[model samples]
Target: MSDKAYDDRNNLGGRVRRYARVGGSVGGLAARLAGDRLFGMKIDRDDHAMELAQALGNLKGPVMKVAQILSTIPDALPKEYAQELAQLQAAAPSMGWTFVKRRMRTELGEGWRDRFASFDREASAAASLGQVHKATDTAGHALAVKLQYPDMGAAVEADLNQLDWMLSLFRRYDKSVDTSQIREELAERLREELDYALEARHIALYRHMLADEPTVHVPAVYPDLSAGRLLTMEWLDGTPLMRFTDADQETRNTIARNLFRAWYVPFHRYGVIHGDPHLGNYAARDDLSINLLDFGCVRVFPPRFCGGVIDLYKALRDGDEALAVAAYEAWGFHNLSRELVETLNIWASFLYSPLMEDKPRLINPADNPGQYGAETATKVHKKLKELGPVTPPREFVFMDRAALGLGGVFLRLGATLNWHQLFHDIVGDFSVEALAARQNQALAAAGMEGTVDGR
Candidate 1:
């Protein structure tokens, strides 16, 4: 390989290029913020936001990860930026065959092509950390080949540095929720996603946890062909979720039910959740069942945290303030005043309303399609503004991200369900110790190091 064949992302030159790309992309927004704050000039957030988003979309890296999570959090970014950033596709166009050849040789040796019956030179799918190519093994079994982008480790750190600056500016403008915890958590998850080895383990864990879930499918990992930066797995087939958005009501409802189970069964039973619920992470099958595609962003919660989620649900249903307080504390929220708790409960009520009702119904019936949680989020923002700063525990960020992301999917499907029964069945048999045991057992079975009792 030539010296310049692969970008030296850890070198000074690479760092300069990345930072320059990022700054050039969003410099206008930074200028707007600076002008609005320093020069006493008015700058609308909506101005050039789409162009800014388009600029970011043209590249793939940390900004996309940060923006994806921020989109799930209400009012984290100005509405225009959030909307535009949400539209940023997670994947960039696939790197060309030259890059692929170099990457394949690095991971699988010079004879890499001979290991497969045939490997597509073009990427079938691309995303922030890596792109996937469809291939077949020597035996002709279908496979998905995931190859990490070069120097992603360095790229992630560089992007996080830039993220720190942007987040600080955001804090300067709006201090409604202290996002330090959220930012740090996102950094950890994004770096973790760069590790295909860890992600392969996550895939194993999910397959084990959802073994009984006939409606959900998990792909099998191929250790022989997988490495720290490359992952090979069974190529599962399904349709992207958007294809089902305009389907018949029955079909949509069935798909929604399957999705809910796919997401929550892991959490309610094993204390693990698929942290990333972007539309690209899932696909629908002919039978209305769904395949969970991406396992790179899984989160394993403490058992006490899982218990607290149940406690909060019961408190909300029974109107028990004492239980609610305990739940909040268990979640690591400190310095909560009565008014603050009440303010938090206002948002909680809206999230839990669907499940509180026994009858089957749309997740957000009164609102128009694609408008799920818009009104409630605005109300929550207003209440939080009035009640003063409420620091969200780090755990809440991903939980809320996955929850809200799934809710958006439900809205897109227009699915109706007896959410109350679904909630009851999951929580009825729940025990803190049992969940801890289940979590530990599942992690151990998958060769993962996790103890639910660990802090």
Candidate 2:
């Protein structure tokens, strides 16, 4: 190992420092609740949120990850905490050269330097879980090397405990939604991301699935050079998604159309969905094509679940209550009382409203620019409160998150299209049995388990 290379941040001393830093801040916030038993001196949730963000920002791994999770699940965090955590998704600190050298040695062994024609010392990009470095192979092919931060598994488990406490606090503020299932889902997906071998196969699966898609691209994984923590893939040169915001309407619309296909084609045609949508996961080429990056958070659902999504859309569009209830059941939602069903429909209506409208329009039709589905979310929250604590089925977590994240993307592009037509173009030939066959073949070929977290 190189000198002081690959710092053992997951070691006892390191973990203690991490926990102490966060616990000290959180402990102060929890003093009243701890002493008085959930209610005494009031905790300023917003202030507590800022302190938590500060604590996470100071640390390397867990806080940003937990923040990313809270950002996805609706009402999982208070607005203040969510916003703070959301920022951390893009602003993770990078590991220094010594750490990088040690990581490369571990992944590629002593002769790692000779394998690359050139490797940049500075990271091209960094996130909570890992950092990417630009490199060139001996044959001159550009590559992106993503190195997982050391001891991420340990840090993740430790921080997930803290996340539990954070969510408990959130539940105190809003008892409408029981978040235990959602937490389990987050933990499952986050742990899955640690397995780069699985992700490499996800890349292969996408390559096979999207072969005919002219507007979408998935990188080629280097299996020989990749380990459980390190992934090497062909570098995609493209502009960031937001860089197109100032582009012409036609260009923006084309980009949005491509994004729509890139995201949904796999879901409708197969039972897979890319679970993360943090904007950084995709980029736009000169012709407005998309480069799909990051396969770590892929979710492969049962074909029935995929069919249920469309069924719910059709039910909402046609106002078929019976179909809607069946679809809910298919999605694994238990005993849906009339009021709860009505509340869920309100939220579903917002998601499906775009496809119902035959005319071209903005995704978020509110008069003022707002968070996509903000009003709908608020209304649903109010209704859920009235209806009492509701357990959200596991499948709903990432599905809902990806939907809102994509809508936010469209709103940013200011794209206008007959969303109804676009949606139909994809869903017109949907078949449950066919998707089941396709999903099974894909899973078998990729050597992946059929269930997402044994669900």
Candidate 2, poorest ten consecutive residues by summed lDDT: 1-10
Among the numbered candidates, top lDDT falls to: 1
- Candidate 2 on 279-304: residue-level lDDT in tens? 67889998889999888888888778
Backbone clash tally (model 1)? 0
* Candidate 1 per-residue C-alpha lDDT over 1-455 given as tens digits, one digit per residue, 9 for 90 to 100: 56254653466666767788787777767777767766788866676667767777887776777777786677676666676676666888778888888888878889988999999988999988889999999999999999888767667777788888877877786778788888878988887888788899899899999999999999999999987778999999999998888889899989888899999899999889998785688898888899999999989999888888888889999999999999999888999888888877877887888889999998876464334556676777777777777788888889877887788778877788998888777777899889887888899989897434454
CA RMSD per model (angstroms) = 1.9, 2.7
Q: Residue 39 CA error for candidate 1 (Å)? A: 3.3
Model number with the top TM-score: 1
TM-score, prediction 2:
0.92
Instruction: Find the 10 residues in a row with the least total lDDT in model 1.
Output: 1-10
Poorly placed runs, candidate 2 (over 4 Å): 1-15, 25-37, 40-51, 366-370, 449-455
- Model 2 per-residue lDDT at 360: 90
